[model samples]
Every structure is written in structure tokens, then in C-alpha cells.
Target: MSTVTNQAVGKVTRTRGSRAWRPYLYHIIVGLLSLLMIYPILWMAASSLKPNSEIFTQAYTLIPSKLEWNNYVSGWKGIGGISFATYYKNSFIIVIFATIGSVLSSALVAYGFARIKFFGSAFWFGCVMMTLMLPHDVTIIPQYIMFAKLQWLSSFKPLIVPFFFGVPFFIFLIMQFIRTIPHELDEAAKMDGCSKYGIFFRIILPLIVPALVTATIFSFYWRWEDFFNAVLYLNKAQMYPVSLALKMFLDGESISNWGGMFAMATLSLVPVILVFLIFQKYIVEGISTSGLKG
Candidate 1:
């Protein structure tokens, strides 16, 4: 009996030992995968500090033999007479206005859909959902013609104005989030003489802050990186965003400023990284909770 008990205890110890090593193996695999994914970004940042001559020669190296801080200085000076500061300003303006417009309009529309039932509400919501299937390429030509007729080309109006009408994705995200909230709160607020607008502003808005933040992050990232629209509409060098200006670093007639471009490219990533790091928690919470209705 003692021999059998000892054998059982040995078997349990072996199982426990195996389980303890599994997490370390999983962690190592994950760490290697993460490093692989981030390798290009790490390389870009490292290359930005290297001299133009050594950038290609030592392509695989993550450490610079000599730091070329002048790459940042020259990149900031920009192509032609315009500074990168102007490009940054232009990008920020478009992103900020677009983010604000999309977030507020989407939330309001979502509130209406989630709480207030009206005639043709289902049909209209279905139409909004259908818009998600329509590609931007299909509408660009007509939109361009319309904007041109309004004399809105070569300005930020075309980029900013369209977003004020509520993005379908954000509307859907916030709507799902709003549905998770108890309807009893809306009823209670109504009993206190709160209007539809009041319920939206006072109750719904505050509760869906996570979804709103997630939407805002998405909007900011999209508008900041909008290259195709900016290229189509913006003509002036002064009006170019960072996304468009990055292309200027390559001159067909001249040697491309590889070092400078890499430096600016690294710098451009800062805002996106910062925004994600700060609001990443909201994104996870918003997505996870939005689907689970109370």
C-alpha cells in the first residue's frame, strides 16, 4: 500500500512539473513572435539614426556606428520652402476635426437607433449597414465632381465635411455598446422629465465613453494616415499632410534623402503609438462589452 501511495505521489509530481514548464514555453514562443512582428519598426528607428552611406551597407544592424542627428534636422527643413511643421499642423487639423465630427455624430445616431424606435428606423438602419458594403473607390469620382462643383478642392473642407454625417462603423459600435446599458435608466430619466436629447447627453453618452474613446482612436488614426484623399484634393505644398509629404522625400531627378525620410517616418509613428498606448484599454473593453447585452 505504501509503495502504491509513493508511486501515485511521484506521478502527481511529474504532472505538476510538466504544467509549470508549459507557460514558460508559451511565453517564449509569444515573445519570439512579437519580436518578429516589431522587427521592421525597430529597424526603421535604428536606420533613422545611421548615416546615409551606412544605412544600406549595414542594413541588418540595429545599432548605428555613428548617430546622424542631422537626418532629423534636414527632414524637419522639408522639401522646398515648406517645413514639416506645416504638414504636421495640416494632419492634426484634419484628424482632430474629423475625429470630433465622427465620434459625436456616430454616438448621436447610435443613441437614436438603440433607444428611440421610429417609423422606418429598421429600414434606415439597414441602409446604413449596407453602406458598409460599398467601397470608397465606387463613390470617389462622384464625390470629387460634387466637391469640384462646390469649389471645395485644394482645401480641407472635402476631408472634414463628409465625416460630420456619422461614420457607419462608429455608429454601429456605439449602438451595440448603448444596447448593453439597462433600458430602465432611460425610463427613469424619462420619468424625471428628461427629453430624448437629455437622455442621450446625460445617460447614454457617459456610459458609452469606452466605445467613444475606441471610435475616436480609430478616427484619429485613419484621418492622420489618409494619403489618397489628401493627394487628390491638396495641391499646395503648404497644405500637404505628413502622409503625402513623406512621398516628397523621394525625388526622381535627384538622390533620395533616405536618412531624412527614415527619421521623419520614425517621428510620424510617435503620435500613433502614444494614442494607442494611452487608449488601448478602452478598445479592448469597448469591443468585449459591446456585444454582451445586459
Candidate 2:
């Protein structure tokens, strides 16, 4: 009996040792992968502090011999007359309004599809969903022609206006979220002498806050990074956003301000990082919960 007991104790000890090593192994693997993913960003930051010539010389190394703080100052001044602040202001103005327009319009449209029973409602909703599968590039030419006819080209109007109509993907996302919400709430609100608009404002609006935030985050990020539309619609350098201004740093792939570009590029990521950190919880929860319901 003593021999059996010793054998059992030995097996338990072995199992404990194996289990203890698993967590450390997992952590090491994850840490390595995390470093791999962020390595480019780290390199960019280090290079931003490097001298222009040293960027190529020390391309493989993340550390520079001497840190060049002036890269940030020069990058901020940018090329020619306008400054980086002008690009930042333009981006913020477009992003804020576009985010609001997309979230609000998508919510309203989604509510109509989810709650209101109107003629041809199903068909219209189907059309909206179909747009999700449609490629955006297909609409560019037609949209540009229409904007040109309206004399809306070479301005922010082209970028900001379509968001007011509702982004198809966001409309679908919000609609799915609204479907999960119990119709009983709407019914109860109606019984309490609440009109359709009142139900939307008081009940649905508050409940779908997470979904709306998800849409807002996505919309803001996309618009802030949008280069295609900005380049197509905006002709004047003064009206250019950070997306285009960054392009100006390169002169036909020959002479480039490598240090300054890296510096500005790092600065450009700040807003996106801050936003994601702030709303990350809601983003995860919203995307997960607002799906596969009624």
C-alpha cells in the first residue's frame, strides 16, 4: 500500500509540473507574436528620431545612435505654405460630422425597417442590404459625375454628404442590433401614449447606445483614414487632410523626408489609438451582442 501511494504521489507531481509550465509557454508565445506585430511601429518610431541619412543606414536596427527631436517640428510644418494643424483641423471637421451623420441616419433608417410597417418596406430594406454586397468603387464614377454636375467636387461636401443618407453596412449593423431589442418595449411605450418618434428617442435610442458607438467608432476611423475620396474630391492643397499631406512628403519615390514622414505618421495614429482604448469595451460588447437575434 505504501508503494502504491508513492507511485500515485509521483504521478501527481509530474502532472503539476507540466501544468505549471503551460502558462509560461503560452505567455512566451503570445509575447513573441505581440512583438512581431508591433515591431514595425517600433521601428517607425525609432526611425522618426533618427537622422534622415541614418534611416537607411540603420534600417534593420530599432535604436538610433542620436535622437533627432527636430523631425517632429519639421514634420509639423509640412511641405509648402500650410501646416499639419490645418490638416488636423480639416480631418477633425470631416470626421466629426461624418460620424454623426452616419450614426444618426443609420439609426433612423434601421428603426424604420425594424419597427414601422409601411408599404414596400421589405423591398426597400432588401435594397439597402443589397448595397452592402456592392463594391464602392463601382459607384465612384457615377458619384463623381453627379457631384461634378452639382459643382460639389473639389470640396469636403462630396465626402460628408453621402453619410447623411446612411452607410449601408452601418445601417445593417444597427438594424441587426435593433432586432435583438424586444418589441415589447416599443409596445409598452406606445401604450404609455408615446408616439413612434417618442419610442425611438426614449427607449430604442438609449438601449442601442453600444451599437451606435460601434458605428461611430468605425465611421470616424474610416473617414479619418480616407485617402481615395479626399484625393478625388479635394484639389486645393490648403484643404488637404493628413492623408493627402502625408503623400506630399514623397517626391516621386526619390527624395523623401523619411524622418519627418515617420514622425507625422506616428502622430496620426494617436487619435485612432485613443478612441479605440476609450471605447474598446463597448466595441467588443456591441459587435458580439448585437448579432444573431430576432
What is candidate 2's lDDT per residue for 74-106, written digit by digit as tens? 999988978999999999989999999999999
Weakest lDDT window of 10 consecutive positions for candidate 2: 285-294
Best by TM-score: 1
How high is the CA lDDT of each candidate model?
0.95, 0.92
Cα lDDT tens digits, model 1, 20-100, are 999999999999999999999999999999999989999989999999999999999999988999999999999999899
- Which residue pairs collide in model 2, if any? none
Least accurate 10 contiguous residues by lDDT in model 1: 285-294
RMSD of each: 1.3, 1.6
TM-score of each: 0.97, 0.95
Error of 1 at 184 (Å): 1.6
* Candidate 2 positional error at 235, Å: 0.8
Clashes of each: 0, 0
Error of 1 at 274 (Å): 1.3
